[model samples]
Target chain A: MQNHKTLWQIFAAPILIGVLSSIGLIAALVGDGWWDGISWLTLALPVLLYFFFVLRRRRVNS
Target chain B: MLLLCITGLPLIFHHEIDDLLHAEVKPAEVAPGTPMADLDKLLANAMAKSPGQVPHFLIWDRDDPNAMFVSVGPTITANPVNNRLVRMDAHTGDYLDSPDVTGRFTYIMLKLHTDMFAGLPGKLFLGLMGILFCVAIISGIVVYAPSMRKLDFGSYRSHRPRIVRWLDVHNLAGILLVMWTVVVGFTGVINTWADLVLKMWQFGQLAEMTAQYKDREVPTKLTSLNSAVEVAAHAVPGMTPSFVAFPGTIFTSKSHYAVFLRGETPVTSRLLKPALIDAETGKLTDSRDMPWYVSTLFISQPLHFGDYGGMPLKILWAILDVLTIIVLGTGVYLWLRRRKTGVSTVRAIAQTSAVEAPLASS
Candidate 1:
């Protein structure tokens, strides 16, 4: 394992995902059409990321 | 909490489930701009169908504008909680079918999800649990920081022992879904207080609005329901009638018909404004936006249900709900494993960050 990372480094991805999820939650509530599309894309990020990480086999040499 | 998640999963697709499970009369297909049948005629048809039942509320179906619902109970003063909904055609003023929805799968799931068949106290208890769930999520975030310090985000050490692997899954899913889980969970808690909030509105704002009519007895000769809604529509420009609470029901005073109107936009559609029409004269008495608390409850509903954005959003909600179930399951497993080894979860997580040692050796 590498040396201890800063709090920002540890939280960067989570904070980003959280903000995007919040946007997704409110976007569809505000309007329709493109708003709904935007919400679907933003909200799908975490679910997609979850599957990508859990299913992808890690490289051995890295 | 597991029960809540499991029950809530199917509820995300409740409309589709209900359609698949039950057969009912369909509204006749009508061309565009076909003027709806008069509200009075529709009410009369529904009343004729259900003998000895008194109408409590007339509701316009949000999903199916071609049909409307009349909620009726045994008596005017009876609790509207168990009132039956009679479906009527919007354009023809003909009684369709009144399916007893209490026995449906979705209804049972909803009852379990909301109150577990225990009424108000059960709802309040679930709300308290929801609050606790929110607190746990917040605390989980704090604990996540140290555990993730040495590992990259989304790092799942698949080769590690079961306990360590699950801890990673829990952390990854938990962190990613922080916003959604908290919003849905807390909004669910807000929904539990709906009964109390309506009671507050009835006594506070509704009372103040109709205080002048407090002394008047419920009109023996009620005016036309059609005109009351028409007056309400005129009073609230650019809005459509959502539902009307008949006089002598829990939602209105004894002498005024409360016509609730909704806006056209997506956001405004959820927020309702009530226009009180004098039941005797069928004239507009008063109109006002709902108080903030009631408005909050209304806004929180869609956020919790994930029904606002159509089918795709509902599917996403179901997936996220399943992920949450996994999170909850892993959390329980971790706790049980920790107890077996006699180590607190926080310290175990802290130790994992330092040396990457497996917590459970199998």
Candidate 2:
């Protein structure tokens, strides 16, 4: 397994996604259209990623 | 606190549940370009229903287009418990349901979620709890970072010891839900302070807005409510009147009516534009954007309530809420389990001998 780390992993990703989720929540409340789309995607990102990884690993192992 | 989250999950889906439980009979569809039922007629009906009482608020539901809810009270500053609420067909002026039964239960859930049946002190106490919860989440993140550096994101070490595995699960879920927890928690804290904030506005901006009319008498022979609405609409172009606050209400002065208008877009819709009207003349007195303090509270509501993106977003909110409950439960579990074995009789004995032996040697 690769042990290398990057700046994005250490700093950018967490902070960016964290801020994005907040924006998405606020925007969704502001009204609709693209705001709603952004809300759906950002809010769903984490759990979606978790499942994505889990299913991919299962398939590979099987 | 656990009870708060459990109760809050139902509240996230409160719209669906409330609609289903207290469904009003929809008014029959009218022809295109049909004029709305007269506001004056509805006001009269509301007054007739509650003799001697005055109308506090007239709320038109934008989503339903033909539904409305009105609150009538004995006084302008009457506590919610003292108000009589009625829902009606806005287009037809027909009483769909009067003497609300479901409203009490819904309000109880809100009060419980808000202050646990206590008032301001309860609100302030919950605000402190929210701050502490935020602190816990922050400290958890700090402690979690080093472990995270070693493992990939979403790592849950099933093969590890029970506590360690739990720690991993806790970290993953907590981090994933961190944005939500912070937003909800922070907004919740703001909401707990909403009453105080509104009072501050009343003392400051509202006072200034109504300053000119302070000496005026309570308006008795008022102008038409429809005209007041029209004046407010004209004052704010491209926006629709959301509600009307009658004279002598806290929302307005003793001699003026306050017509609250909302914009079509999302951001402006939450931000109310209030136009003060001359109660006797049906003429606009002053109109301007509400101060930031009041608007901030208004904006915090939907963010806290998750009422934006319909069913899907609410479902997402519920899921995150459940995940947070798990994280919180596991945290308490780990702490109690460690305390039972690590900090009790065996550690006490070890500590005793260690202290005694060191003293004796010295």
Candidate 3:
């Protein structure tokens, strides 16, 4: 189980990231105007959050 | 890591270099009726002086007073190597000496960065390398997930092996640049097939051009290509001409001349482009903004390369590229080390007595 991650934890980051990215992409298609401003941040947030959560879990266990 | 570092460094400053080398000239109002014959006469006399060539495309100064450019190639070849752009007076046929294209550092950098002079084959090869780079980045992330399980996002456990130090750097770079690398990699793959993309765009997006001219009066009358060009300037004010596609060429219809315009701002910069002019009357009949896919390609260009922002952005790009190179080196190193260790473990097991070996190994 050392390498195993719970289903929720494993899927959480990707799902959240996917949703944000999808919003940005749809906003881009629809000319939402505001999405253009924060599009990069939207794309990066999920990946960063995933890293943060995983690192936090590791530190607590150690 | 090494590859990332090198490419990242150049990617960071590509825009800066572009800005440093060229000054923008916005087009000024010339008489709508500026005779194209004058521009053509100037170019014709200039080309005749050169040993052997015919013109391919003509470029006009978008902003300068009395400036035009003629890009020519040997009349008989499709090869781009023979192509040359001759700058000339727009109103007079006075030839401006061709800028020294050879021996320029920018040209050398572009050649190495794009194709390494092997041309298509080299581009295809580099594209494959870009894929390998993508794979290395992905795998580096996979390995890092396990090691960083207990550390903070930027935490470096210095007490670990030299390989670990390198691995942490590799992981951080790969993770940070995951999206960027994918975009650049995919785009680089598409660019390797540049000729195909242009052909596809011509036939797909501008299918209207072909249909429009099919029944129209053909502009076969040699109305100095430059005249149609000036006519376009009259129609589209503040538009600087980049390249012109002639009638009967694959890029245009029999009745229209196509002129590409360059954009002026950081965001509009990549999107500045093609306007269609009536070949016969020198009227700006129609124009094309970049399609979605092409626009995506354009915007992705700066993000993927990290070249749009100023010097600070460039430094960031360089750091990221170096990190990618390190990731690649560490990946290769890790693979080799794993293989060696596997072999030693097998040897040690084989040398032990049967019961003891099995027990010890377990």
User: What TM-score does chain B alone reach in each candidate, compared with the true chain B?
Assistant: 0.96, 0.89, 0.71
Positional deviation of residue B156's Cα in model 2 after best superposition, in angstroms: 0.6
> TM-score, B chain, candidate 3?
0.71
TM-score of each: 0.96, 0.88, 0.66
Q: What's the distance in Å from true for residue B151, model 1?
A: 0.7
For model 3, what is the alpha-carbon lDDT of residue B205?
Answer: 76
Q: Quickly count the clashes in candidate 3.
A: 17
Off by over 4 Å in 3: A1-62, B1-51, B60-68, B88-94, B99-105, B212-221, B224-227, B233-240, B248-250, B253-255, B262-264, B343-362
Residue A3 of model 2 has an lDDT of 76
Q: Give the interface RMSD values of the models in order.
A: 1.6, 3.0, 7.2
- Candidate 1 C-alpha lDDT tens digits along B216-296: 988998999999999999999999999999999988999999999999877899999999999988889999999999999
lDDT of 2 at B146: 59
In order, what lDDT does every prediction score?
0.93, 0.77, 0.59
Better of 1 and 3 by TM-score: 1
Give the lDDT of residue B204 in candidate 2: 82
Q: Scoring model 1 with DockQ, what do you get? A: 0.71
User: In candidate 2, what are the lDDT values of residues B237-346, reduced to their tens digit?
Assistant: 99988888878877788888899998877667778888999998888888878788788888887788887787778888888888889889878877776688777432
List DockQ, one per candidate, in order: 0.71, 0.36, 0.11
Error (Å) of candidate 2 at residue B13 is: 1.6
In angstroms, the error of model 2 at B234 is: 0.7
Segments in model 1 whose C-alpha atoms lie over 4 Å from true places: A58-62, B345-362
